[model samples]
Target: MLEGKVAIITGAGGGIGRDIALLMAQQGAKVLVNDVGASLGGEGRNAGPAQSVVTEIETAGGVAAANTDSVADASNAKRIVQNALDAFGRVDIVVNNAGILRDRFFHKMSDDEWDAVLKVHLYGSYYVSRAAAEPMKAQASGAFVNMTSTSGLIGNLAQANYSAAKLGIAGLSKSIALDLDKFGVRSNCIAPFAWSRMISSIKVDSDEQAARVEKIKQMTPAKIAPLAVFLASDSARDVNGQIFAVRNNEIFLMSQPRPVRSVQRSEGWTPQSIAEHAIPALRPSFHSLDVSADVFSWDPV
Candidate 1:
């Protein structure tokens, strides 16, 4: 579906990003596979992962190249996108899938831990999207899919830093969607629940975590690739600013932060009065957890 297009995918060395890169290439899009070959928490390095994907794409008769640039840095991000342009002549799509996790409760999270996650997940998206936007603007056609997570959307314990950064990507997508319409650049986010390498390594102590992992183990990285592929296609031209959840062979349209209902003030009220009045109104609408829904069930059969 992405025939004759060129795509740049960050963190394409393994897991969801790797799956996405291969899928895009298979669909006839020339792909730039970017990854620093880091660990689950974004530590250490190996260039092998990115090269492997490139090799797979080439073996499958798809055009692909490898990039080792760190998306966490603005300068490196620019270079990553620039490499795509230099190699393929233009960038028609960008998948901002590069991320890291510093899983720790708020009180125990270190400054570096917090800063690193934020920089890679949030700022990394910003740098690459910002760099790619110009080229997309120049061409007057482009698609961007930013990878968010269920943890980011619903908030997971001990993942405050990771969640904050992921949620920030959602907000960033919305704002960029508004600004890029004039340039015909479409932006959207995918909060996937696939069991990738990162999620598989998450330390699960409590029974809750165990059950959650068991459920997620049913979903694969390959299943998450199709929505991302569609989002990067010309068919999704009007699907801008939307956040989607991909899991268990389902695709759900997720909601953003919006006012549910409001309470009117009888007078200049105190905190207790507002709290009492607002609790009932907001309780039913506020969701602590997002129930799984299958939004993408049928395809052309």
Candidate 2:
């Protein structure tokens, strides 16, 4: 579906990114696999992960190049895009799948923990996408598939940093779709339900949580690649600024933020009036403090 196209899949060393890179190449996109083999907490680096994925792609009769640049830095991110251009001539797709997790309760989270997570998942997506925007605009066509998470869309325990970063990515993607649509560049987000290195970080403290993890394991990283490939292909031209979720075999067009209920007064209301009248009317529309797992209550069949 992506014949002659060139793609950059960040964090393409392993997990969901690796699967996406392989599928993109298999579908005929010359892929630039970028990774800075860091641990889940965004510490240290090795080139083995990226180089290995590149080798895997090449061995499977696909075109790919390995890049060990960290997307967390703006200059390195630009270098990543430039490398893709140098390798494949013109850029066509960018999958912002690079991420790290530093799980901690809000009260106990450290500044470094917050900054490190945001720098990798949120800023990294922005840095890479900003660099690729110009090339896509110049060519008058491109697609971006960003990885978001239910942790953000719904909620998650002890993941303030991660949820915030993922939610910011959703907004960034929407802004990109709006800003680049005129130039024929499209952007979308994927909230994937998959068992990967990222998900392996989940803290399973209860029997129920363990069972949930087992169910999640059934939805492997491979299940996510098809949707990523589709969103980054010409086939999804009409689909822009949309959020999607992939579970085992199910694909969902997730809902975006929209006003569900409203209360208005012709005359300006005071706080007291709002408290007395609006609060009662709007209470039913208010959302509960439910986490991702709570919202996804049923197992994916």
Candidate 3:
């Protein structure tokens, strides 16, 4: 479906990013696989992962190039996009899947942890998309598949930094969609539930927890790639600013942010009036503060 397209997939060294890179290539998109090859916690780096994926694509008779630049760095992000333009002459799709996890309770979270997570996930998306947007705008055609998360969309314990960054990404994607719509560029966010190196680091405190994690691991990262490929294809030309989730074989179209209820007084709301009238008026429509796990209670399909 993406034949003749040129795509840049960040964090394509492994997991979901790797799967998307491979699928895009297989669909005949010339891929620029960008990966800093960092560990799960955003530590260390290597070029092997990126190069290996490039080799795999080449072996499969697909065109691909490897880039070992940290998406967290603005200069590096520009270079990554430049690499794609230099190699392919045009950029058609960009998948911002680069991320890191620094799971910690809010009270225990270090400044470094928060900064690192935000830098990579939020700022990284901004930098890469910023660099790619100009070229895409000039061409008057492009698609962006940004990675968001349930943790951010809903909520999750011990992932304040991650949740913040993910939510920011969703907002960023929406704004980008609006900003680029006239240019014929589209942007969407994906909250993917897949078994990857990042997911493998879940803390299991008991046998049941281990079993659950194992079950989760069965939802291979590859399963999430098809949706990304679809979103990046011409088939999704009219789809923009939408959020989606992929769990096992199930694909969910998440509702965008909108006002559920409103109350008005001729005088407008004062604190006392809000507490006395508006709060109660809007109570029925108020959503509970449920986390992602609480909402997704069913076993993976």
Candidate 4:
């Protein structure tokens, strides 16, 4: 589907990103597999993971190059794109999947933890996308597949930082789709329910939780690659700025924020009027404070 294209996939060392890189290459795209090789907490780095994936690709008769660069840094992001250009001469697809987890309750979260997640997920996405925007504009065609999360789309406990960043990525993807439409650039997001290093961190304290974890385990990271490949290819040129979720073999077109209910007064709302009139009028439509798991309660199919 992506014949002759050059794709840069950040976080391609393992998990979802690794699978996407492999699939992209198999589809005839020359891939730049970028991974800082950071641990789950965003500490330490090694080149082995990225290099190993590249070797796997080449051994399978696909084209790929390994890059160990931090997407959290603006300069390194540009160089990542540059590395792709140097390898294959043009940029066609970008999958912003690089991320780290630093889970802590909101009240107990530290400044560094917050900053670290935002820097790698939200800011990293922006920096890389911004750097690639010009090149894609010049070429008059491009696609972006950003990694969002249900944690942000719905809610999650003790992931204030991650939820904020993932939700920000959704908005960022929409903004990019709107801003770059004229340049023929498309951006979309995926909220994957896959079992990876990130999801493996979920604290399970009961038998019920353990069963839920087993269900999640069936939804492997590989399940996410096909949708990402489609979004990054011309096949989805008409599908831009949409959010999707994948669970096992099921794929969902998730809804974006839109007005479901509204209440108005000709004289405009007052504190007293809002309490008596508007609150009651809109009460039925108010969303619950449910977490991601609550909303995605059905067993993975």
Which candidate tops lDDT? 2
Q: lDDT for every model? A: 0.88, 0.95, 0.94, 0.94
Q: What would the per-residue lDDT of candidate 2 be over residues 1-301, giving only the tens digit for each residue?
A: 9999999999999999999999999999999999999998888999999999999999999999999999999999999999999998999999999999999999999999999999999999999999999999999999999999999999999999999999999999999999999999999999999999988988889999999999999999999999999998899999999999998999998999999999999997999999999999999999999999898889887
**Tens-digit per-residue lDDT, 117-228, candidate 1:** 9999999999999999999999899999998876777766788888889899999998889999988999999988777888887787889668767777888888889999
Local error of candidate 2 at residue 48 (angstroms):
0.6
Candidate 4 lDDT, tens digit per residue, 10-115? 9999999999999999999999999999899999999999999999999999999999999999999999999988889999999999999999999999999999
Worst 10 residues of 1 by lDDT: 292-301
TM-score, predicted candidate 4 vs. hidden true structure: 0.99
In candidate 2, stretches whose alpha carbon ends up further than 4 angstroms from where it belongs are none
Tell me the spans in candidate 4 whose CA falls farther than 4 Å from its real position: none
User: After aligning candidate 3 to the native by TM-score, how far in Å is the CA of 52 from where it should be?
Assistant: 0.7
Clashing pairs for predicted structure model 4, backbone only: none
Q: Write the per-residue lDDT of candidate 3 for residues 165-185, one digit (tens) a residue.
A: 999999999999999999999
TM-score of each: 0.92, 0.99, 0.96, 0.99
RMSD versus native structure for model 1: 3.4
Error at 230, model 3, angstroms = 1.0
CA RMSD (A), model 4: 0.7
